[model samples]
Target: MATRTIIVPEGMEFIRDELGYAPAVRVEQRLYIAGQIGRGSDRQLVADKEAQFTQVFENLRQVLEAAGAGFEHLVEVTSYLTDMRDLPLYMQVRDRYMAGCYPAWTAIGAASLCGAPGYFLEVKAIAELD
Candidate 1:
């Protein structure tokens, strides 16, 4: 049986302690990352669209790094947005972090996220580890 390991990067314990969920889980060579939002380490959400998208990616990066992986290892990604109009900016910010490593991506329009109105974006991903 493949061992399941919960990944929680340093300084991100709030995800498990408060949120009651692991940021990512690793089973063998596959890592499944939970939806990351624009919240900072202090648990405050970034309000600006561009900045929020960046923060969300940063959070994902932390999770990936904790699993000894990077954006290049991502095989699939799913993004949730409160407004479909924000797609362009989201793609732009995402590309900045993803560089040229394009992964299978799906974007979905959401009415709300994190049980709040200001939370505009969330991202989840799957990665293949070395």
Candidate 2:
């Protein structure tokens, strides 16, 4: 099987140079996306909870797009939140992006993530391309 790495120019420096990992890797019809945090194109974490959640999904969308897939193609989604209290806000943002098609999902409460201060959440997804 051939593996294609999905590279996002805005996120490549840290994700590839610093972290040494591809943001997404596609093999066969399946694409595996790395855990995406609420960071801007510049790699800085967003402050507001709602904005952070949006950024996380936006990042996922970018990777999926690069892989020739969309939200509807997502087969599974896993989200990690530092605070479960933000679930309501998360659902609101998620609905805005993924209302029509719902994928199997898991939400986990994380005490902390990657030692990044002010980072509150991370989302990872698996997509099956048509």
Indicate which candidate wins on lDDT: 1
How close to the true structure is residue 1 of candidate 1, measured as C-alpha lDDT? 85
Per-candidate count of clashing residue pairs (backbone under 3 Å): 0, 0
TM-score of each: 0.97, 0.91
> What are the lDDT scores of the predictions, listed in order?
0.94, 0.86
In terms of lDDT, model 2 sits at 0.86
Tens digits of per-residue lDDT for model 1, 34-88: 9999998888889888999999999999999999999999999999999999999
Model 2: ten consecutive residues of lowest lDDT: 4-13
- Across 1-130, the per-residue lDDT of candidate 2 in tens digits comes to 5967665545455787778888888888898899988888877789998999999989988888877788999999998999999888889999988998889999999999879678888999998888
Off by over 4 Å in 1: none
